[model samples]
Target: MPCELCNAFENEKSRIIYSDAHVFVVPILHPIKDGHVMIIPIRHAENMKDLTAEEARAFMTAANLAMDAVKKEYGVTPMFLVNGWEYRSQPHLHAHVLPSKTNLRGLYAASEGVVGKIEASVEELTITADRIRVHFSYES
Candidate 1:
């Protein structure tokens, strides 16, 4: 089967908030909260160990940028979640930058579920993506 992150990376429809040689950052299609985003490596790394040195550094850089943006945008230091194995929704390794009080991967594993649907609309995603991209620009 084709990798989801690869597809997303190649898919023109995907809203990429930030990107570099090693990784690309995008807002999660189904976020636990509004400001939640993902820092995904370009390679199909299923786990942290799979990432090379450059990809790891790029991933961390993306994480830092996403966290900084989330803090600046939401006024809160968001949670960083590294999902893998049975807990991961997708095969590609991606770390979620969540701005919610609740822990995601663990909480989702143990609890009944989250409070409500976090599926963002296309328009919302577009606006959110645009807003986030501004943080990476010198204009911001």
Candidate 2:
């Protein structure tokens, strides 16, 4: 079975902040903090070690834009996180754009994913995504 994150990314019902042919950014189901977002490569590459140069670049672009958008839409600091679990199911490459003001230790303590006190609404997410696309994406 595919990882649930892949399925969640496909569902338009979820809050999507950014997307392109090579990548997409969606709200974290298990947010590590509020305004938390996930920037994912379209192709399933396990982890950083597995990502090709092109794929890494594309994902980085998405991550950079997602962080800017998140900060603009919600006043909070964004943290980029990647946990590689080769032994885990569906080890795809994904970047977590988590926004938080709390200290580092308190940040990782939330097992279920820290829910950022501020979350982007569906409309806000769309707008932020569009803005990012216009400013940074090739299609822009």
Worst 10 residues of 2 by lDDT: 103-112
- Candidate 2 lDDT over 9-127, as tens digits, reads 67743456566677788765444445666777777766777877877777888888877766665667677877535423346677777666744323345433434433345665555
Q: Which one is best on lDDT? A: 1
C-alpha TM-score for every candidate? 0.81, 0.65
Cand. 1 TM to true fold? 0.81
lDDT, model 2: 0.62
Q: How do the residues 28-77 of candidate 1 rate in per-residue lDDT, one tens digit apiece?
A: 87766677788888878888889998889888888988888877777778
TM-score of 2: 0.65
- Each candidate: what lDDT? 0.77, 0.62
Name the lDDT value of residue 16 in candidate 2: 62
Off by over 4 Å in 2: 12-14, 84-90, 102-140
